[model samples]
Target: MTDTNPIPARLAALKTMSGAELKKQWRALFDTEPPLFNRRYIETRLGYRIQELTHGGLKPETVRRLQDLGEQLDGGNIATRRIRTDLKPIIGTRLIREWQGTEHCVTVTRDGFEWQGRPYKSLSAIARTITGTRWNGWVFFGLKHHRRAA
Candidate 1:
């Protein structure tokens, strides 16, 4: 007997396909090599592709709305193309750190930082003011560190 539901049958078959076979299918479907060799990833993406081929994918308006939401979440602005979510401190957050023997506090602002009743453009400037030497403010405040060898 022949199967009627071709898409569902294809999706089911994807679960049992080998990595090389999945990569070949991925290249046919997406015109590119599969990003990884994981079985679950291949199955899930193939299922999605099968569904997309059977029924149309997301609407243009939905795509636009999603892009707009992503931009907003990334601190959307006309001037800045991209904003790093890791380094962006919410306004009114107080960052306290001990430098040398003294405790220094900085309040996060929309534009920059406020420290010791003075406004500074960058945390590194504040670090310089406090330490009297050049320092990475993110490292000084324990926000980031140098990468270690793998």
Candidate 2:
């Protein structure tokens, strides 16, 4: 019998194809307009799509597990979360904030954080206690700052 697997040939061809060729193949394989990402992104996604079409996509349970893990990683907001593991301060670093003229301090700890001699799982909880309002932990702690539009 002839070589049974078509995946290897199809994937190998991608390395040699031009950007235009990849876009053309993308339409054929994906049945839609190609995304506006760079050529390398297109090639990588195309490679995965090829294998996915041949072997089927990820299992539902696996997809759920990934989402759960992402929730933990994204601090429960995966829909718009960016990679932020690098932003967490080192243990023992004190995060200080001033709310309504009172200086507040939160210490980074082995298990989440500490404020006012009590343990807190997130900066948001401490913020809510301090302000009585829900807030993004990172934003509350001043780890992320957004520029306002004028």
Candidate 3:
């Protein structure tokens, strides 16, 4: 069956157009010189512009609601907010502990932990190997507590 949507038909034509042609269309839609020569970028922006012109842009209330949601997710305090992973010690941090009257040192790496010049999958493995028993790596290394109130 033949599709009757002009927007889809125009977008499909955009896929086959030359870079120069896409840039020209970009200028017409955006009223400015295109930023880059990427065909996909031009096609996507142009397609959105076409649809936006046909069916008006988002309402002001909708935009305000979206911005409020973004602020809440960002913790509402941008200066003090940090990415979740930043709470952990950085790579190359050294964790030292005494197990069975012997000192064990482990170095944090980007990929995994390194102990005594040997690579280990986790601190629990090194702890088990050192103590001859199962242990929670974080607790064994004092990175976490045995239990929390919550």
Could you estimate the TM-score for every candidate? Answer: 0.49, 0.53, 0.45
Candidate 3 lDDT at 94 equals 96
Question: Which regions of candidate 3 fall more than 4 Å away from where they truly are?
Answer: 1-4, 74-150
lDDT of 2 by residue, 13-129 (tens): 999999889999999999999999998899999999999998999999999999888777656754336534556789899999999999999999866789999998788899999
lDDT of 1 by residue, 21-108 (tens): 8888988988987896468867898889879978989999999999898777545664334435456688899999986788999998
lDDT of each: 0.82, 0.87, 0.81
Winning model by TM-score: 2
**TM-score (C-alpha, index-matched) for candidate 2:** 0.53
Off by over 4 Å in 1: 1-3, 76-150
Global lDDT for candidate 3?
0.81
Rank the candidate models, highest lDDT first.
2, 1, 3
Q: How much is the lDDT of residue 60 in candidate 3? A: 98
Which rank order by TM-score, best down to worst? 2, 1, 3
Better of 1 and 3 by lDDT: 1
